[model samples]
Target: MNIVVPVWGDAYLDTFLEYSLPAQLAAGNVPALEGSGHCYTIYTTAEGRRRCEEHVAVRQLTRFVAVTFKSLEVVATYNAGNKYRTKSDCYAIELEAASRSGAAVAMLNADILLADGFIREALRLLRLGKRVIEVTGGRGLQDPIKTALDSEFREYNRIISISPSELSRLWLANLHPQLAMHYVDGPEGGSFHPSHLYWLAGEEGVIIRAFHLYPIVVKPNASPVKFSGTIDDDLVALLAAAPDERLIAQNSSDLFCCELSPPEHFVGDVAWRGNRKSIIDFYLGYRTENIENLEKEIIISSKPPVGELWDRTRRDSSDFIDTLISDLKSELLRRCAAREADDLMAKAAAEIEDDGDFIKAIGQMLENGHPIPLALEERSLRIHLKTYPDRADLLQRLCAVLGAQGKVVPLELEERALKAIVELHPDRRDLLERLRLVQVGLGKTAPPAALVSPSGEEASQTEVDFQQDAEEFGRAVNYRDMEPEFAPILELARRFTMTSVERMYALYKAVQYIEATQVPGAIVECGVWRGGSIMVALAALRALGNTERDIYLFDTFEGLPRPDDDKDIDVLGNRAINGWLPHARGNERSNWAYASIDDVRSNIGLIDYPSDRIHLIQGMVENTLPAGAPETIALCRLDTDWYASTQHEMVHLYPRLSVGGVLIIDDYGHFQGARQAVDEYLAKTGTPLLLNRIDYSGRIGVKVQKSSVGWLQKLGWR
Candidate 1:
C-alpha cells in the first residue's frame, strides 16, 4: 500500500508526519512510500517547492524521494479552460506517478493526520475489491500527540482505530464527501481512471466498489492552510460522472477520522465540541431526529489557537450586544414608552462599559448620523447628569441629540438643567425661552398671561417677548459640531434662509433613498431657495464621492411669480393668512422669496465639490422644468411655495422620478399649494403613494410600483 499525499507547501508537513505517517506505518500493511522506492510527488508554487525541499533535508527523511515542481503549465495545454484545471493539473501528475508503482494508492491531503489502524483496514477493504474508500472527519477526533511535532506516537489502537466489522455495524451514519479523504486501487493499463481525462476531454473513470470509513478515520484539525482558488464544483462534477457501488462504514466508538466542524447548513443535530450534552444523547435523540441546535458549532478544523478563539468570541459577543440593543430600542420606540427603554438602556450601558470596543461601536454609530434610540439617549443623559450635575453644556448636547429624533428630555430633567443654566448665566434669554417652551411641550401649564404695561396702551409684551412667547422656539435642532453629516450644510443654509430641521431631514432622506436603492439618476431640486437645501444634497453626494449623478436646480432665482388668477387660485385663497404669500414674497435679508442664480452659484462654490456636476437653471419651474429637468430623477425636492410652480414640477418630474426614488415636498405642512399639487397629481394618476411626514413641515413619498395609466392611455382606456 502506498499513501499518495499531495502537499502544496511545507506549512503542515510537521503535523502530517507526527499524526498521519506513523499511524499508516503502524498499520503494518506495507512499506512507507519513501522506503517503497515509489515516486512521491509534491505539487506547489515556486516558493513552496523550494521550502518543501529545504524542510525534507532538514528533517532528514532520507528515504523519501521529494519531487517538487513550480508549474504544471503542460497540464493547462492538456485541458484548456477547465474550471478545475488547478486541481486537475496537480492530481493528474500525482496519479501518473502512482500508476508507475503498480501499488494500491491512498489519496490524502497533507493537512489531515490519520488515526491508528487506518492503513490496515483500508488495505483490507481494498484487497476485498473496494475501489474507493472515503474517510469523514468529525468534531473532537484529533490525535492529542499530533499537536506537537516531536511528540512520540502513543499508539493506543482501541482509542485510535475503527475496525471493518465495527464500521459495518454503524453503517446508518451519514457521511459527506467534503471531509476530503479517499483511497483508490492502483489502475491497470486497461482500466478507467480520472487521469485519462487529462489527455481526452470526455473520458471518465469508474469505481466498481466504494467504501466509507464513517466514524471519521482522520483528524483534519491541524494548523490551518489557506487555499487561494475554488475547484469544488468541478471536482463534484467529475465525481458524479464516475460509476461506483458505494459502501459507507460508520465506526461506533468515540473515534473520528478527522476533526471537522459540523456543517452549518445542516439543520440536523451533529455533536459539536464544547457542548455540555453527552455525545450518545446528541446522536440518538437529536442527530437521528434532525433537530437544530441554536448554538451551532463555530470552530473550524483549522485548529486555531486558544487566543484566537477568545478573540473571536469577544468580537461575536460585541456584535450580538449591538443587535440586541438595537432591537430593544426599536421596540421601545414603537411603544413610545421612555421608562421601558430607559430600564434596558441603563442596564446595557453599564454592561458595555466593561467592553471598550462595544462602547466605541455605539459612539461610532451615533457619529455616523444613526439616531440614538430614545431609551439609550435618556440613560446616557442620566449617567452624564450624575457625573457632572452642573454641566449644562453636556445636558444641552444630549438634548440636541434627542431633539433631532423628535424626543424631549424628561420634564424634571429639562426644568433642572434649564434652571441651573439660567441661574449661572442670568442673561441667557434663549435658555429661558427654551425652558418655557419645554414646559409648554410637556403640557405642564397654560402659557402665562401676557405682561401688561403701566401706560394703559395695551402694552402686552408677549408679542415682542421672544423668551416667554413664540409659536415655535427652535426651528431646527442645533447640530453644530455634533453631526458632521449635516453641520456644514446647515451652516451654509444659515447664510441665506432659515433652513428648517424638517427640510434638512427630508434632504437627508433623499440621499439615503438614492444610496439604498442604487437608483441610477441625477437629483432634481426644484425651487432652490438660496441654494441651502440643494447644497445639502450636493454636499452629501460629494462626501460619498458620487460624481456620477448630476444635479438639476430649477428655480426662478427671484421672488415667486405674482399669482395669476387661473393658476394661483390656491395661493390667493391663503393671501390673508399671516405666514402666506406676504411673508414668502419679502425680498429683504435672508428671505427665501428671492433666490438669485449668482447667489446660489456662489454659495455652492463655497463647498469643496466639483462645480461641473451642478447645473443651475434660473427660471420659474413652470418655464424651466417643462424641458430642462433630467429625464431620470432620484429625488425631486419641491420648495416652490405657489400652486402654479408646484403644479409644473409635479407634471414634469413626478412621472420621470425613478421607481423607489423619493419626492420630498418641503412645505407640505407649511404651504397649502404644495400639498394641493401633490394630492392632485396622485389623484389624477391614481398613484397609491402614501405621504409620510418627516417633521412638523416636510412630507415625503417614495415612488411605489409605477402606475400603468400612461400605458392605459396609449390603449385609449381613459
Candidate 2:
C-alpha cells in the first residue's frame, strides 16, 4: 500500500533512513500496483524539503517524494492559512493523502522498524477481517547492523492493521472534550480532530493511556512500557477519577502501540504517584483543536452550548496544580539522594580503608547495567593498576570491560598487561605476535620493541625493569639506576620535558642511524622544548666517543610563536591542520606549546658533555633555519607542532639530509598539521621514503640513497 510519511524537522531523519526504511523494503512488498503507484509523499516544510531532496539524491532513495507542505492535496480543500501547527496537524494531511491513494495506509513513525514480510502478514491479517491487529514490539535499535544480524527478529516481529471503524474510534478518543486543546468545528456543523496517534492505535475502545519514566532524549527506544494492553480493573477505576497520576509520554513511540498492560504505578494507590497527568491525555490537550472561534482558546469555554467543556477544563486545571506541587516534592527528595551518592563517592576517593567497598560498589553498578561515566571507571582501574601491577587477573578484567564498553584502553595499561602475558608464557610467539599486532592497531608501540636488547634477543633480565619503566616513561623518563653513568643528564632531562615511549623509540633509531650511516653532516633538531632529546643524543654520542658532528638546536627560546590566522589554513583533504602559512609572523598568543632557551641550556648543562660541537639557533626556525641551516644533515628531528613550521623544516632539511640518514617526525600522529605537511612534501617531491610509526604520536623515516635524481626531477624537483 502507498505510504505518506510526514517530515518536518530532523529529530529522527538519520534513524528513519538508516534503519526504518531498510526494514520496510526488506519485507519485499512492492507498491507498484497499489495506492500512489509506489511513489510515496513526504509532506514537509521548505527546509525539510531541501534536506529530503539532498538526502534522496545523495543516498539514491527510491519511492519517496520530498514534497512541500503547501503542495499537499489536503491544503487544496482546507483554508491553507497556516492550519498545520503540531505534528498531528501535519499527520492529518498525511492521512488524507493516504486515504486518497485507495489502499490501507501504513501509519508508521520514523523511529519504528518493520520486519521482513511485515506488510504481507499485515495484509493477510486484514484479509481475515480483523478490526485491529497487535504488532509485535521490536527490540531497541542500539546498532542497526547488530539488530539486523539478530536471527530472532523473524519470529519476534509482528504486523498490525486498523479498520476504518477503529480509526474513527482512535480519532474521537484523541479529540474528546477533555483531550483536545484548541477546537474549531467546521462551518457546516461537521468536525474533525487532529490526533497524532490515531494512525498507530486502532478502535474507539482501545484507550492509549501513557505513564512517565526517566527520559534520556538521545535514546528514543528506552521506554518503560511497550505493547501495553488490558488495563488493570483497579487502574481503570483510579484513572476514571484521577487520570493525572502518571505523566504524559513524549510521543507515541515512547510506549509501543501493541497488546500489553500499562505499568502498575498508574494503577495502584501505593504506586509512586507524584501526581502526574497521563502522557496520552497531555499530548491530546497540548496542540491543535477541533473547533475554531472559541473563547481565548482555553481548551474549554464556559457557555450555554459548551457548559460541560467548562467542567472538563476546571478538573484538568486542578490536576495540573496538584502535579506541580507533587513534582516539587519529588525534586527535593531526588536532590537529597544525589547528595548522599556524591558523599559516598567522595568517601571512596579519600579513604584507603574503604577501597574494597568502593570497588564492590562500582562493580555492582556495572553488573546492574547502570550508566556510569567511563572516566570514573577508568580512574578506579588506574588506582588498582598502580596498587597491584602484578595482578594479571585484574588487568585482564579491566581490558575486557573497556573492550566491551568500546572504550580505548590507555597505552601504559595495555603494555603492562602485555608484559604480564609474555612473562606468563614466554615461548608463546604466536600470542606475542598477535598481541603486538593488537597494540599496533590501537596506535600503541609494542612493549617487546622496548624490551628487546641490541643483540636482537629478548631482554629477559630487564623485563621487570621494563614493566616499571613503561609507566614511568609515560610521565617522565629517567636513566637513574638503569644507566648510572648518564643519570645526571637524564635527571635534568626528565624534570624539564614530557617523556613518552615514542620519544625513546625515535631516539634509539637516531643512535642507530648515527652508528650505521657514514654521512658527513651535522645533527639537527628543528624544535627543542627543553633540549631533552638533544641531551640524550649528545650523551649517547659522547658515550660512543663519536662527537665529530655538530648538534644544532633551534627554537623560539621564548615559547611558541603566535599563529598566523589569515594565511594559516585550518583544513586540507579531510585532515585538520592547526595552521599553514607560506609567509606570516606569529602574532596571536593563545595556547600554543612554548619553551625557553634558558631551560634548554640548563638541561644541556646537567649532561656535562662537551659543548664545542653544540650549536644553539635561538630564534624561530622559519626565520633562522633558511640562513643558518647545516649544508648536510645526518640525523634531523622535527618536533614542530604546526603545519607551517613542519613544512618549513621539511623543505629546508629533506634535500640537505644525507642519504641513509634518519628523519624523525615527533608529532606525526598527534598534530594533523605536521602530518599533512610531511605528506604534502613527500607527494610533491615524489619521495619514496617509508615512514614507520614509533608510537601513537611519532614516526621515523630514512632518506634512501639513490643512483640518480631522475625520479625526483620527474616531479619538477631539482
Top candidate on TM-score is: 1
In candidate 2, what are the lDDT values of residues 1-718, reduced to their tens digit?
4345554446556555544554455433322123334445565566766666666321433543222324333432111122212233344444344445434445455555443444554455445543222222212323433233243232233212232233222323333331221122113222222221111111212222112111100001111111111111011221222222222222222222211111221111111122132222222222112111011111110112134444454445445435543554465566457546645654554454466776776665434323234444555676687788867656865765564344666766676677787887798664576566567766775443453233325555434555544544542343332435545545445534444534754575477556665555678898787677887787777767776456778776544565434333332222222322111123421112334455577778766565645667765576555545656778888986677889999998888887877899887777677888899999898787778977667888878768545665566654
Kindly list the per-residue Cα lDDT of model 1 for residues 1-718, writing each as its tens digit.
Answer: 4444544434445444444444434333223232444334444456655665565332333344344343544443121222223443455444444445445445555554454456556656655655444433332213322332223334443112323223222221322222211112222222221110111001111111111122111111122212211222122222221224222333323222443222331212122222222222222211111111111222212122245444554355345434533543464455345435534544555467544444564465344323234445555656667778878756765655554333544776777779777887787666787788678767875765554333434446333544332334232334432456676566655444445655685686579668767875678887776677877777777777765466778776654555433333332244413333332432211122444566678888777765545667655564344445655777888877666678878887888787878888877776566678778887787666767977656788887653554565566543
Error of 2 at 309 (Å): 99
TM-score for predicted model 1 compared with the true structure:
0.33
- The models' CA-based lDDT, in order, is 0.48, 0.48
Find the 10 residues in a row with the least total lDDT in model 1.
194-203
C-alpha positional error of residue 174 in candidate 1 after TM-score superposition, expressed in Å? 77
Lowest summed lDDT over 10 consecutive residues: which window, candidate 2?
A: 212-221
Model 1 vs truth, CA RMSD: 28.7
Candidate 2 lDDT for residue 340: 67
TM-scores for all candidates: the values are 0.33, 0.32
